[model samples]
Target: MAAAAPPHTDHKLGTPILDQPQLQAGGGTAAVTEKARTLDHISDNFSKYLKSAYDDVNKRYDLTTKEGLAKWLVTEQQASQDDVQFFKDGSFDDFIRYYMSGSASVMRPPPPLDDTYPISNYFISSSHNTYLTGNQLSSESSVDAYKNASVLLRGCRCVEVDVWDGEPPSSSSSEDEDETAAPKPKKEKKEKLGLRKRLELRFGRKGSPPPEDQSKPAAASSNQSPDQGADMRIEPWRSNVSTRAEPRVLHGYTLTKDITFRAVCATIRDYAFVTSDLPLIVSLEVHTCPEQQEIMVEIMREYWRGMLVDLPLDSSQNSEEIALPILRDLRKKILVKVKRAHKHPGAADAKPSTLQAPSGEPQRSSSVVSTSTSSSEELPDGTKKPPAPKAKISEALAKLGIYTGGYSFKSLDQPEAKIPTHIFSLSENTLMEVHETQPAALFKHNKHFFMRAYPKGLRLKSSNLNPSRFWRAGVQIVALNWQRWDGGMMQNEAMFAGTAGWVLKPEGYRSTSDEATQKTAIAHHNLDLSIEFLAGQDIPMPPEEDDPKDFKPYVKVELHVEKHEERNAQPIPGGGKSKGGEFKQKTETYRSQNPNFGGEIIKFEGIQGVTEELTFVRYVLSALSSSFSNCNR
Candidate 1:
């Protein structure tokens, strides 16, 4: 039964294998040779595993052969020479555990930032009703909400402020009087036009020449002489500015409490640039009278000093051909976006009535009234009438809306909607309707200008809509209710993870070509993704009292892609209505604190409509008996 065994030799290396352990385990030369052959077989399986299971790592490191992987582990991963030798000598499980625990296991790295593109081209992290810390209807508004949402969160760049007229001070002390006083502009005089010029303005200069102009030469009639029209001069028509109450921020038309607008401004000034130097967008919902609006403007100007971005009054910037400013140009600036008062055809020529006190009382010359009652009138029943419909947005406040001008959305086809500086705000439901009917139009419009979508009015509980729905259509400012930590907020956090509040959109969304607009889905790039559950080590126990042996671990894997559905487009095969649909798979449950999954592999083949850059894979770890789940993206 014991003929002498043959001496073992390493065939690949062409050397005799004479290790003492091998000699002892084998008990003879023939048994040692058999052991060497088994080691070679195990090494071959490990190489195959690296090529298939860790293909992404192989591609990343440019490794095509097992020898290359071994070299990389030693050189790049800093594995010891002994460890490499052990891997090559049949320690497959040990090598894999080491590699997976290191940096080689990272599936996604931080995305590179390209901030040179126009700000409209990026997805801005935004918050809706930023002052509300609870549900929309009855929440307490506080400045702390702004502090948390903007700086503490580290990425939100856009915040909302709904401003209303605050309660006036009880008595007009010297300090109170100074606070209510509006800063007046320096007066400048200009020469008014004579009758001939006035006639030309009323009619056309081409019409009948004036009696005084008939005697003049044809050249003088066609063009004004140096001193021809300079006859009478008067002060430019100025609005009778009245004293204002303190401006307040709150959720309008709700039971939400108010926070002083000055406090909000102070918070913004202190914390806006704390997390990121990128520009902060203050979306102002002005529900105040003109006087209080001016107070809002003064507060911002005083607090933000040089940081305020002054919007140019140039008409050309509104043209569709022009683009919004790039991020590189707007660093550390505060941009206010408020609804602009629409100018009618002859609005400039219409004379505004002087603001007079009620019942012929003396009007305050300093635009600071002694009491709030000075601005309101007593009704016949001794009750003051509700203040006149919130006055049109004041000129001073309108000027602060640099770059982003809030506009009421009518339709994409409207002329005003084409303005590059105009940001059309839409409710979630309205945006969904538009997406269903005219998705191509929505995508194309967002390419030139910004579109903001907020929660619908029915979201009284402050729930959030899936921002991805609007994001897929190239919507720039998807303002979510920051108070609720739901799936929408999770998705939002994932969207701007690496980038500081601004993420460049996908190429298809940024493209201006008609082909890009027409194509609703990304081209199918076939990829085979294989995920293997190797083992779980040191899994934490549940917080509550539970038996350790009863712990059963499982993982649910979900592949989320951009939902792309074209109206009237043919349905995808396998009863899928969308080209890129969600796919979910889970592993078998195992009962152990540290469970071994036994190398179970799940493969997804022919995945369609997925851009590696935009797609996300979510893994949810949970137990069968417990409702607790931990989601990782």
Candidate 2:
């Protein structure tokens, strides 16, 4: 049994950083291929199953009438009388069709009941390093992060892209194959500024002002001067500077090849709504120049014009941060979420600037191409910093992000007053640390905001964490490495297979529900669950050579709670003893494929609130070993 972790209070998001995707292993080809085949047949099978179930129910009772359906399906109010009448008039041919089409006559399973909640209130499947198909440093970056389908097809609502400012490497290279390449010297630069100076310059402030200018009145350069018009907007970055080489996608400090943004956008446009009708979020770890930024905006517009969520240009409507819109409000939309600087003093009056590529510009295509726009800065000592490409997000791109803005977060101890209701993304390591020390605090914060926890940097092998823990805390976006197929990925697939990349948050996480009331309701009464163990079929052969007919078998059961506490096991009749007290059955030499357990009943008691939603039971089957007395053995 795991201990229940507490939730925390609300906090705002910090500056946004690069979007990182998860990674994992190349799995057995046969398994993936077989799964793909099964998935292909799902729609047909699902329709048939629904048709059969409905036919059986209708034949057993009158399902075409309002009162009849109400009594039989246990949904009196939801099934409108008119809809029931329509069904009885033979307006619908198949119950499954009507159920899927949202006809009022169908008393479907509750349809994601928490519709009034914001986007932050739901759990969304996401991918890390979405472009990579192998180990981070030496992997290949393909447009298809998901081998079987697009990222969205894989049921990942949030996809990460690494944007840099140079032409991407054409092909992937193996770690050993790249060892002979020449290494660049770290100290090749003749002059370098201190950290403080770099920070000042990075934000567009002078590294060192002239004596005459320094003495002038502080208000003289006020960007917010009354004369400045609404058109004069503050730049997102202090300086149009970038240190990266090109505008391409790749993991940082890795030898992996890169994919062009234009190509990626094309892929997104083609596959946007194939597997899901919900909105798609593009998490950008952007480091690019202004001209390249323009190119990014243009190319994306060309490919995704219709589906992109165009934001309002009106100044008053765009300035304030707000909670995310609900899923239904953003269907088929693509939202780009990236970091923007908070307002600085006099920022309202700052004169905004834009850059246009030089005339007769080179033709741009899905293949890599360079931008003609250029901007550079000069230092006080007559030295020039590397020409960092400057880019200002197009006005169009800025609008779609009205509620999906990005922010960075370091520690909970920091002031959250500046944090906004926008999305907060953090590394899994940071979130796990918070979970360990202040589980309650993290839980509280997630109730009112959107949070994403991704795997840490060191998980180069593309491993995954236990996602259910984060989901329990109301963290909406828990990113996994879709490239690696493992138990975590399997769980992810299982959770989102039939649904559109979104799952309603548990009742405990609902914003409208009171956590205190929920806890109080569960304090006094305990739940009792009885499980029956029947039999096993086609048990695998042991590694040691043994006759299949002579195998001895026993069953064990373990309970898992979404907490840190230890679980106690109950005793079963005719059960064997074990160190962990896990439920176990006495050995039986059953040789047939279908071995019956003789109707063994295992009753569990003392279970309480939310455990049904959070608990998991695992059953194990093993060959029982024989013991011999020392003298008679």
Candidate 3:
């Protein structure tokens, strides 16, 4: 009411506030001082105004109440028009920076764990109950731990978080009711008396003396056959189940296959905010048969997701703080933490590169030096000092995963039979068909596949098609067959075949004399691709090779391992014959690499400066190639 009487005056600067003659006469310095004073007063007013505006808009636009945050995400730093407008409506131009480009706020403090919010209280107080917090009792000789309490903390309305809680589950003898007889109605039906069930299923008579001691008691008592091995140690309740994940009733066998793949998936969806781009990668690595790698696809897939999406952060979550142990690189994680700490709103984390004045030998200075410094010092050369590089906040992401510790992917023992049929595809060189015409890669599923194939790469072709006559057109495809052997059983091998490879010099195609002499490898790696055009069927390789006119399209078949029979078809004297079988492709000389830490595959995109790891990998590879060339000779 008091302000309404006077009609509040706007004191903001740059809005015609410098018209005062005192400020005008004193020149720019005086004007700036006047503007600063006005801004200070207006800042307080603007803060209040913005807070009110934000409160109103947040209630209206927060989509978590309806569609769920996981169901929506913009891949590749992009945003929709509706979102942009929602931001504008919130008056971001007046205040908000539209951080993470309308994605993440500048400062999102972690919810205080012990602060007793209803959710926090649930996670904390439930610990008092004998409910497990997801830790499989890694130590302790007991099948006696409790199940997790509501695993609901995973799908928190806020950013999903997961902590090792490293806290072990406890055992409470709080059975809902005895299976032998119901004294009263129970709260939950998951209770039972173990004795009655054992007597009914394991024994022919109730309360019968066990058969275990009856016949062997006298001999067994005298020849106590020593303690069972440490690993074979078992507990009464779960001695038959698995020693990992759950206590197995028997030492190597699984306890209850109750925890299924779908159950694991639901656990994630119900608890974590899994992005649409990923849920799980139902991958299969064809190793030997008996020990097929059969993990719930959900478990293996989340390692990467946890690497990028989930942070080991219950405290501060930033792109940098996610310590994806699966990624084995401490340095990479540190750099990421630094970047995330920098951009995080209100996150007062230490910056990794807090550039200190570089040792003071030769240094630069800010040209905005005060007049005080101008009069006091001058160099003998009489030139003004170069301006110092003022620190600017950049949105560049710092990734520190994969390059360290070497293994970019995990190799599991899985049978090809387990790999969904949709994931399999014929190699481009093998030339299988969709009605016998289209090239090999014409199908897809919801996962990703990468293949390096040479569709039409050869050393010679009919002069009509081979305009240059020196280089023929045909593709070289490398197929690495990986089969895992577990003890005596053999698992179906999953094939990682390249759909194509590069065209190389004619001599290298026939012999290993001049291998990989400058060629580009073409690889097709799309996750669920849609090849619209039909490449058609592959005609059989033409037998005649002497005349350039009779030359037919041929591909380089690279088998990591081939059978003796398959090897005969392409024994070209100096190398394997080109008719159909075992021949490795020429090595590529100038293949692109991620340029940081190196291996056959680039760790990350972009040409970063080379590091020591890249040098080591190159040296090792060079040595291997040298040995192979020597053997060929």
| Top-scoring candidate (TM-score) | 1
- Pick out the ten consecutive residues of candidate 2 with the lowest summed lDDT: 9-18
Whole-model Cα lDDT of every candidate shown, in order = 0.59, 0.51, 0.20
lDDT of 1: 0.59
Compute the lDDT for candidate 3: 0.20
Using lDDT, give the best candidate's number. 1
Local accuracy of candidate 2 as per-residue lDDT tens digits, 206-283:
112225543333443456556543223222322332432235777643456778786788888877676667878887
Tens digit of per-residue lDDT, candidate 3, span 39-107: 212233334554565556545554233332112224322333344433433344423334313233222
Q: After the best TM-score superposition of candidate 1, give how far the Cα of residue 510 lies from its true spot, in angstroms.
A: 2.1
Q: Which digits, one per residue and each the tens of the lDDT, describe model 1 over residues 442-480?
A: 878887688999886656656677676577778989998
Q: Which ten residues in a row have the lowest lDDT in candidate 3?
A: 488-497
Candidate 1 global TM-score: 0.61
Shift in Å, residue 446, candidate 3: 13
Return the candidate ranking by lDDT, descending. Answer: 1, 2, 3
Clash list (residue pairs), candidate 1: none
Q: Judged by TM-score relative to the true structure, which candidate is superior, 2 or 3?
A: 2
